[model samples]
Target chain A: MKNLTLALAATIGFLHADPLPSWNKSDSKQSIISFVDKVTDAGSPDYVAPAHRIATFDNDGTLWSEQPMYFQAYYIFDRIKQLAPEHPEWKEKEPFASVLKGDLNSALAGGEKALLEMAMATHANITEDEFSKSVADWLATTKHPKTGIAYTDMVFQPMLELINYLRLNDFKVFIVSGGGIDFVRVFSESAYGIPPERVIGSSIKAKFEIRDGKPVVIKTPEIDLIDDKVGKPVGIHRYIGSRPIFAAGNSDGDYQMLQYTSAGEGPRFGLIVHHTDADREFAYDRDSHVGQLNKALDDSKTQNWTIVDMKKDWKIIYPEYIESTPSQ
Target chain B: MKNLTLALAATIGFLHADPLPSWNKSDSKQSIISFVDKVTDAGSPDYVAPAHRIATFDNDGTLWSEQPMYFQAYYIFDRIKQLAPEHPEWKEKEPFASVLKGDLNSALAGGEKALLEMAMATHANITEDEFSKSVADWLATTKHPKTGIAYTDMVFQPMLELINYLRLNDFKVFIVSGGGIDFVRVFSESAYGIPPERVIGSSIKAKFEIRDGKPVVIKTPEIDLIDDKVGKPVGIHRYIGSRPIFAAGNSDGDYQMLQYTSAGEGPRFGLIVHHTDADREFAYDRDSHVGQLNKALDDSKTQNWTIVDMKKDWKIIYPEYIESTPSQ
Candidate 1:
């Protein structure tokens, strides 16, 4: 009698275990389940072949915590400081000087031009191999300002589960982000289980040349492609050459990408991860400077896109880390 | 006694089934087989993991015949005439007018700039979807100038075998070509079993916008990345994000790509297809107007790269097509 009861309990447990444990049983979670089911179901009219089951995600806001500021922006700031000794002119320059002094507001005071100048100083004139190693080193050592945890640890627990679930259902997951491609690529394969080739993003130009009878890629400051807003769909068309069946984003930058994916033939899924947990994470959206989600939020309702209210929809905000402490 | 005789005959036939029937038994063929064996052998020190087994091929002259003129060049020339009715200026234009008059020599007199002008007119200023459809439609209807066979049928049989052989050994094959990415992608999967995502090449700028409340990609005339010579390595780095163990090409355009691949840390293989079979195919190399193979030909010997002599290394030049007729 005892053995039979144990077996019955085990079967029940297997049936009840949630694939996305961090995600609460809300309509947002329900929509995800329904879409995956419809696409994967052999009997369903919306069944898509595994080859065509492409799912793209906005990395910075959708996959991880882009709060405080974008994570890559933090890396770039550190790079500016590290590269200051070589570029003495940066000490007196407006943007680089501000960056060095830890005054971000003053640095970004000049807007996009200032950002590009800072980026060029730190991101270019180095071999690609060197740049990649620097990114890897920073990712290994850096901690999130608010979380007091490794930046990698700030990745949302729920998003990880969702990615795994999609992968299990034979969907080819791709990171189509506005972040620097090389920067995201260093950590993406290890952190998010997305390969380097599958990640697409903004990139600076790189020149290939033979130096001392050896091949080396020299990254130049010239902006190659800005893969945000209108550029996302173009990047998708250029790189993947196929329309994604599922798209996820958290900002207006992803508006066109979502629009492109949803407009494709047959059933498509669009999702937004709305920052609603002020206590655990952030609360601002439309007014926030980083990852502003204004037009996309309003469009979500009309488009029937699932909006995950992080406070109610996410049972947990981030992965547990050794140094993490709850805000009092 | 009869059964024993038959068994002996079958065993003899099995030993010489010829995996690459179009390739003659030569050092070039031996080098390819040896490299593949070394990389795939689990016990060998040079053994590469399946994920890292990337092999890139240059498409035009390497995989298929680019004789007389490039097959796509023919397509572009035909498009100029087809589109001439809409643009009255083309009737008197230098390159366009020369193209319409069937004066190939005068059309190419201005060189690369003239080619770019033609490409921008026919290859851009339309939706990517529409351009793809146009290429597909042309491929379906058009035949090669001399062969009377579909252009797709002109693919080199030995190269196809080599691609298949690499795939069988768990290598992921990619096409890194000077040709437009979209143009190669249309037939790559069907002809070579390499998907669109696996092909990287030159591109023109594109814009994403909402048309009639629907998102679409509009190709612009501006050049993006030119995937030739030095650009090949840059494209490979940007797309694959890893150095290929094996690289193959047929001209000076692929010199840097071969150099990049051969310079990697591990045991690398570089092979060049030298067109030498004048009887079976066009044999111009050093003095050829298209796919000029001058400097790289000298570099191949020093680098120890395999140079495949079409006359000596290949038993057949092209794959037999349904309507293929021997050139009289």
Candidate 2:
């Protein structure tokens, strides 16, 4: 009788368990739950087949903190430092010199052109395997500038739970990011439970060749797809070959993606992660240079997109680590 | 006693059932079974994880009949006839005029440039959904000129079983074709059980746009990736994000794909479908106008790729449709 009582209690606990434990009780959380329920329930009018249950998430600010500049920019800077000794001419090069001097503001003063130059210099010529290995190595040793935590660990706990929640409901989740594809693929599986094949992002052109009697795909110093803004929808059309029923983003960079997802036929869910928490995490939007959220935030109400107030909606910002305190 | 005896008989039959019933007892069939067994056996040294068991197949001649010109070429010609009323200028245009005149040789005399023009004319401007709808309609109404069968019905039965066999072994099957991605995606799922996301092929540039308050992906006239020959491996790298453990193809277009797959670490399988039966199917290889197989055929001996002789290996060339007989 005691064992039966314990078993019954355990069954009830399992049945009533919250999927998104980090998310507090709010409209933002309820919207997500209700959306999943409507789509997965066959008796509901908004029932979507398992094959059509594709959910896309923007990586930079939506899945993780993109503050203090994009994490990939830091990777490019680190790669420039690692490859600096070989390129003596880089000492006098404007962007390279500024990057080496540790003046990120001055280095980025040239804007997209300078960033593209640095990215190509470090990212191209090597085999795809080598490039991914370098990214994995840098991620293992490097720490975020402000948080002093591993970059992968800075992923939003609530968002992770949401991903798991949707996946549990038979949604095929994909990361449609503006970040480099190769760089994001290294940790996507370990961090987000998303695989490399499901990652669609910006990329450099690559060529296949036989080197030393072994096959290698060498990255070329040419831009391929820039999967940001309008390109996000194009990337989705080309890669996923279907419209996502659910989309999530944190900034205007994902404005078109949210627009496209919400425009799809049948029941659709669009989520905007508004960084409203200044105490728990860095909070800057609208006027902020990186991850500007003006247009998407303003249009969220008109678009029927759910706005996630980080400070209010989320109970925990980041996953708890062994060494760090909640205050950190 | 009867029930017990019948149950024992059914169990024995299930255990000894042949996975590839259409494939004759040949080295080609044995190689596939052995490779699958080696990779799936947990106690074997050559075992590969389920995630890494990716098997890619070329579409046109490898999976279906591509003898009387390419199948997509036929689709282009049909589309031109359907849209000829919109552009009266096409009636006098060189290639278009030849296509309208029913002179295929004259139309193709202008070579790749002429083919590209025809393809772009028929394929571009429409939304992706519209494009796929046209492909489906064409497949439904059109019949093969020589075989008098539906295009989807032209799929090789042996290859179909092989795909199913690999899928049963937990290998993810993908259609890596030289055909247009959109065109192949229309029938990939229904015909081969390969979904749109698993089909990687040649593509034209497309843009995401909003027209009349609806989101649409407009196909552009310009080319994106060709996904033929060397481009196959590049597509595999960019799309699949990893080298396939098993690769199958028919022509030289798949040479690099076979090479790349075989060169990967650990056990790998490469197969070449050689059409050698004039009575059963068209028989032309090294000197064929389409699907030239010279280079890959010669390299197969050194690469240790299994060669499937269509006539000798396959018990049936095509599936047993309601209207078709074994002689077909």
Candidate 3:
């Protein structure tokens, strides 16, 4: 009788518990909950089958924090620095020289061509294992410039709760990012509970080769898919095949993905994480060089996409804050 | 009391049941079972985590019959015939002219270039929905020229059982096909119990477009990925991210994938389905127009890969036979 009573109490507690605990009681939170509820409810007209309940999230800003610059850019810069002694030509090169001088803006000034050159030099001409290990090592040792926190710890607490909530409702959540596919894959599973296969992102060409009687996949300098802007939806179609019912992103990079998600027939949801909290997290939009939220932010209103104001909607910024703060 | 008895009996039956009932008692069957058992056993040194237990199967000859020609090729020819009225110039075009004359060999004589022309002409320049609907319609109406069986029905029953068996043992099954990614995605779920997202294959470039206020993905003529030969490993890396522990294929196309899978530092299993039964199924190896099993066949001896001789290993071929032959 005691066991039965305890089981009942546990069930009730679970039923009443807030899934997104880090999310403040705001319209953004309410909209997300309502959409999930309606779609998951079998009796509702907006009901979605579990098989079709795919939720894709943009990585850099949507799931985690991308401030000052993308975390991947830091990785690239660091990688260039590490390999600087070997490549003497890089000291005088446009992007590499700028990167070494700690002038990120000047490095980026050379545009996509320079970025691709650096990405290829650092990311390619090595086995997939070696590249993965290097990324993993860098992430383990690297810290954000201003926050002084480990790069992985900078992930949004509210977004983590949202991902958990989605998964609990049988939604297969995926990270569709502009970041390197291989780079994100290393930490996706450990950080977000998303397996490597579930993470889709920009990639360079790679080929299989036999080295010392063992097969190894070598990353090539050639650019393959660029999972950004217009390429987001293309990546979704190529990787996922099926259209996602729900999509979340930050900045104009996510515009096409949200557009594609909302365009699908039946009840669909699109979410945008608008960084509005300057004190808690970095706040720059419209004119921000990295993760600029201009066209997506403006169009969110017309598209009926739920715009998440970080200051008002999220009670907590990072998971570290939750551990530090005492519960009432 | 009766319900309890039935439940206990069901549990016992499940524990002892032959997962691959279609597979005859052979070395091939034993090897597969042994590998799965060793890897799944918690106390065993070779035990693999469920997360890493990925199994990839080649779609065409590995999962279904690709005899006479690939089933997708048939779809292409039929599509060309249906669209011929719209393209009068196809009457004089080299490949198209041969296709119109019902000469498949001549149509294919132009090789990959000719095939791409026909594929793009029929397969592209339409919305994804239209293309999927057409594939569905074709499969529903069409029958194999030789066996008069529906294309989907031509799937090997033993392979189906093997896929199910792996899934039962906590393996995530994926279809890595040389066929068009979009083409295989249509029936992947229904035919092979593999979801669209889990199916990786050759693809054409597509872009998201808002046509008449509705968002639609339009397939373009541009080829994006060719998931064959060395391309197989590249596709696997790009999509799966992690190397599969278990890999199955029937042709040289899968050679690289198997090589990659086996080279991984773990207990791995590679399977080659040798179409050695001309009476039951078409037998062509070393030299075949489609799904040529040459180098892989020769190297299998050294690779320790289990080669399934169709005649000796499979008790039943297609699922239709199982229905016709009633259990004693």
Candidate 4:
């Protein structure tokens, strides 16, 4: 009788327990659970090999917040300000002039042309080690404009839980993004449990050389590769070789990656996060200047890719007390 | 007295015992030994953290023979011949025409431009899976023109032992090659014990889509990314962001990779394989059209990189016939 009563209590506890407590049970949550259940249940004929269990996530909006402007862009802006004393000429430079004026809108008004100028000026002429240190220093102190939180702290806790859950099920997760390679690598391990090597992103040219009896590599202004849109699939093929079986994205920029991942043989999953709750978090998707999600939405129904409703799926947004405590 | 005799016998056996009996230690053998010893010995100051134990090898000359053109090109030539009847236009195509006419020199006369055309015609319009199968089928029957041995059989036994040795010491060994991604993926695992996903190489475009209620990806004629020369470091950064602590190469093309590997913080090893024995194997460098060693030789001296004198360290070149043959 004692054993039967203990077994009953255990069963009741298991039934009431939330599988993904860190994530609020929303439509996004349901989609994740349904997809994971479908793929993980061996008895249901959806079991996948550990080798084939590859999951790719977009870095910016999908994994963290990319509102107002990209967090890395802000990091670059702060970097320019910090280095301003050494290079007084940057005060008179066009984009740098606007940047110093605190008018990022006008500074980036020229789009790719202006952004390239800013990137070249800030990312070049330094040894990779120096660039890494500069980035680390900037990220350590930089805060998001609206939330008054550290840029790193703005990451969605639900996504963090999702990453952990996928990894627990033998999934090899990779960050495929358009962000700078070194920039993402700085915090990927601590924040996402993804080591620097597994993070694939845009890159600038680097030169090999020896300095002070030790070999060193210096970053060059020349753009080596752009890992975005069509480049995503190309990057995945070049770096990863095998197509991913699962992909998560929050914008149209990740469409190709999701397409490539879902197009592979056997069980596959493609998920798109829809930011529709303004009270809990900022809400803007289709027409958002940063991470536009329009084209992906149009194809979501046709492709049968899962659309995660942020408001319905998530019980919480960022981690508890994230607004008070910086992520770094 | 009996115990002393037993101890003497044990010492004699230890002195005579070959640790890697399956490997015919050649000139490149000693460098491999020195590298492994430095990196793997816990007592050595050169000991590296398991995470820092990243090693990369060039596929063609470093891992296997690339003489008479890269083996993958030979595989493509054979593929074109096998598929000749199905594609009538191939008969009149410039490179394909020369290839079909058995004029190897003329087919590759235009270098990468001509090679790209030949590759596109031969590889396009097939699903990625189908292309993999085609490569697997070709490798099974294809033999090296010089040795008349299976292409897989031409891999240096010493290098094979080195790969296993490094892997056993917790080193993450990766193949960063200039060969076609699909071409290398077919045999990398069976030949080198490297899974296809870990192989980074040049690639053509591929498309993902669902067909017949199942996901499938199709290879396209578009040139995606080429993994060669300076492109090697770019590929490495994009795929494996961590700077490798050890790099092995046989040509000037590998100079940048070696430089990049050795440029990382902490202990590193860079080795260049010098082909100097015409008796045991083909010997040509500096002026050689393929695998030029001139630039690398100068850089190796200037950068303090170790150069492997193949003639001195190796006891044998290829695996012994008896060793390679199947057990009775």
Highest lDDT: which candidate?
2
Q: Chain A TM-scores, all candidates? A: 0.93, 0.94, 0.92, 0.90
TM-scores of the candidates are 0.91, 0.94, 0.93, 0.82
Candidate 3 TM-score, C-alpha based:
0.93
lDDT of 2: 0.90
Give the candidates in order of DockQ, highest first.
2, 1, 3, 4
Q: Give the candidate number with the greatest DockQ.
A: 2
Q: Which of 3 and 4 is ahead in TM-score?
A: 3
Model 3 lDDT at residue B41: 98
What count of clashes does model 3 give?
0
Q: For residues A78-117, write the lDDT of model 4, one tens digit per residue.
A: 7788778998998888788888889999888988678877
What's model 1's lDDT at B246?
Answer: 94
Tell me, by TM-score, which candidate is best: 2
Model 3 score (lDDT) = 0.89
Worst 10 residues of 2 chain B by lDDT: B6-15
In order, what lDDT does every prediction score? 0.86, 0.90, 0.89, 0.78
Clashing residue pairs in candidate 3, if any?
Answer: none
Order of the predicted models by lDDT, top scorer first: 2, 3, 1, 4
Q: State in Å the error of residue B225, model 1.
A: 1.5
Give per-residue CA lDDT, model 2, range A232-265, as digits (tens).
9999988889889999999999999999999988
Please list, in the order the candidates appear, how each scores on TM-score for chain B only.
Answer: 0.92, 0.94, 0.93, 0.87
Mark the 10 consecutive residues where model 4 chain A has the least summed lDDT.
Answer: A9-18
